[model samples]
Target: MGIVINQSIKNTVITYIGFAIGAVNSLYMYPHFLGEDFYGITTYILSSANVLFPLMAFGIHNTLIKFFSEYKTEKEKKQFLGFVLLLPLLIILPIFAISILGYDSIASFLSRKNAIVYDYVWQIPIIALCMGYFEIFYAWVKVHMQSVYGNFLKEIGLRILISIFLLSVYFQIITVEQFITATMFAYLISMLLMLFYANKVKPISFRFKIPNNAKAILVYSSFIILSGSVANMLLDIDKTMLNQYIEIKNLSYYSVAIFIATVIAVPSRSMHQITYPITAKLMIENKYDELNDLYKKSSITLQIVGGLVLVGILVNINQVYHLLPKNYSGGILVVFLIGISKYFDLILGNNNAIIFNSKYYRAILFLGLLLAFFAITLNMIFIPKYGINGAAIATLISITLYSIAKLLFVVLKMKLYPFTVNNIYALLIGLLCFFGFYYWEFPFHPIINIILKSILITLLYVFLSFKANLSEDINSVIIKTLKIIRMN
Candidate 1:
């Protein structure tokens, strides 16, 4: 719990830093310098690369996190780490070779009548490899319980570099092609930084030794790779499918909307990084009661925070779209649906971590993969007609089904759930707060209106939350925050 708290604080700080930089880049710099087409190109390239990363890494990153603690000695850990490091090459090298060999066919298949993706297709494998090693090294650090630094580097450092790259384009120092190339360099630099941090935390030894658990590690990694691929597809298939069915320009609009909406899940993402190792440790020790408490508390806290973010987005979405180009305003509903889906994920708390760490984890992920397939199929069916909104609908339905399936599995198979009466109170208070703020228009400027509305909504939410005791944990946090601010 202490680690969760500390890491959550660190993650919150870094997330804001990333968001601040991202705000400047996305809101001002991207539109001002890159134009919407180039901006969309940038986003599409990264999303495409991310979708390929799981395949490149072959799931060894997740497998390492799950099994690293099982090793008893430094020598054993080093050998395990070495094996993990080497394992990706077996997949990435062949994939890269094939990509180069099949570049023409792949390009022809992907290039629609309106879209010309050939210029950027080559960068995908490079970005994938860089991202793959970054995750692998980051997991190396996570297994050592030094995740905060890695997360800061990942969440803040990478965005900061990208911001700088965008600024270069803004200053007329680089063409769109140069900016695209520089983007690959930024990822490489980020990966190198991860390696440097990994070395600083625990020097990587190149020793390889055969261990009894190596077979289990390989098997787990294989399944994890499949799971990671499915999860990545769940997140990115919409963008990819949209490219196939709609005009390329829509991808930029959808990407921006989705990015803003996904920010609501920041707290959940932050908590998951810390919770994963903790959940693994708990399961190792057979601490079901503490794990259950963690699950419930995390769900409520995440829901509270995520709900606030969702409310802010929903209430001020008009203002937000006004900040963007008029063309992107069409994505408002997309934002709403995706935002809700991400919040639903937040309400699940550490359900994913629990499932991944538990003995039944593989089966759970297999079920999730099946759900993800259905999601992709739905998107494929719907996006051609509904466009971005259809993508959002697919996401909403898939994520809802996925979360429910996970909950049911936890309840029936594990006999565990992450809900209580307080969750109901929190949900009710959140709805009231959203509704209360939704209709109340402030007599101020758009920015000021947003600020005032957010402050008032937060106040009402907090007041009712405390009155209802929706979360004892959050109540304590509010008290402590107030006390600290008062002292200041």
Candidate 2:
């Protein structure tokens, strides 16, 4: 429990640092230096690459985490790592070849009427392959219980590189096309750094000895690819599908709004990365009581933190968008819908990690895949009529249904629930803060309005949270931080 809490805190810190860098790049530099269309192009390419990488990697990364603990000997662990590291090439190489061979057809299918998606399309596979192996190496390090450095490289290191690219754009050192091209190179460098760090953590021997559980690993990876694909569809399909029905520029605007909304999910993402393997180990050891306790605490802690972020964003969304170009403000609806969806996901806490680690993971994943398909269908139907707002509506509806389904499964099948009296108090306080700020008008500048609203909301939530004990983990950290400050 102590280790989990400590690692979660470390990862959360790293995620925030990354988020700070990302916010600057997204909210300031990108909007200031690049047009909305170019900004959208940048987001679209990256999102597309992310969606493709999981398929290209064939879920070998997840396979590493799930099976590496089964190896009892050092030699066996190294061999397993080597196998998974090389396994991605078997999938990536052929996919890259096919994409190259069918480049024209693929481009025609994916590009908007006047858009030249092909000119920049080659970078997609290159970036995806680079990202795919990075995950493989990162997971290899994670199974060794060396997650902090890997988390730094993943969450912080990648963003630092992106920040550099944004700075280059701001200085007119790179054209928009050149900056987009440079993205693939940045990912490649990050992946290489991850490999170096993985080697430093545990030197990879190129041994090809097959593990006894190799077959099981293969089966798990196969199933996880389906799961990964579905998750990707749920997350990225709106942006991708919007390109088909709407103008590329509009897709770009929607992407920016979604980016803002996604910041709400950062806490959940950071905690999940640290807790996944731990959850798997607990389930393997038949520690149901510990698992349930961890689930409840994680839910409460993440909800309070995530809810705070959501409130902060919603309260000052107008001010934040006012800083961007006027054209980008059309995405207000997108922000609301996606924000709610992300908040719901955060509220569900470790439902995903629990399900993924459970014995019934495949069935849970299948149900999720079905829900994701429903989301895609909704996007297809709504995006043409409502544009970005329609995509948001689809996302909110799909994720809401998905969350409800997962919660019911946990309750009926596993008899697990992640709610308590504190959660209700947290929700009520969050609502009060949001509504209080929502209707108020201050005679301050936009920037001051944002700062003032954030401060007020923070004080309100913190006061209420301490009174209700909504988050003991964060409360303890705050106490320790205050003591340090006073001593200083």
CA error at residue 458 for candidate 2, angstroms: 0.6
Cα lDDT tens digits for candidate 1, 1-488: 77787788788778867877777777778777887777777777888888899988878777877887787899888888887788887788899888899998887777664446767789988998899889888888887787888778878888888888888876878887789899899899999999999999999976677678878888878878887887788888788777778777788788878888988988888887778888887887799999998998899888888888888878887877777778888899998899988988889989988877777868977787898889989998889879999999998998889888888888898877898888888788878877777777767677888888888887887888888877777788788999999999
The candidate maximizing TM-score is 1
Per-candidate TM-score against the hidden true structure: 0.97, 0.96
Error of 2 at 89 (Å): 2.8
**lDDT, candidates in the order shown:** 0.83, 0.83
Per-residue error for 165 in candidate 1, Å, reads: 1.4
- How far in Å is the alpha carbon of 225 misplaced in model 1? 0.4
The superposed Cα distance between candidate 1 and the true structure at residue 186, in angstroms, equals 0.9
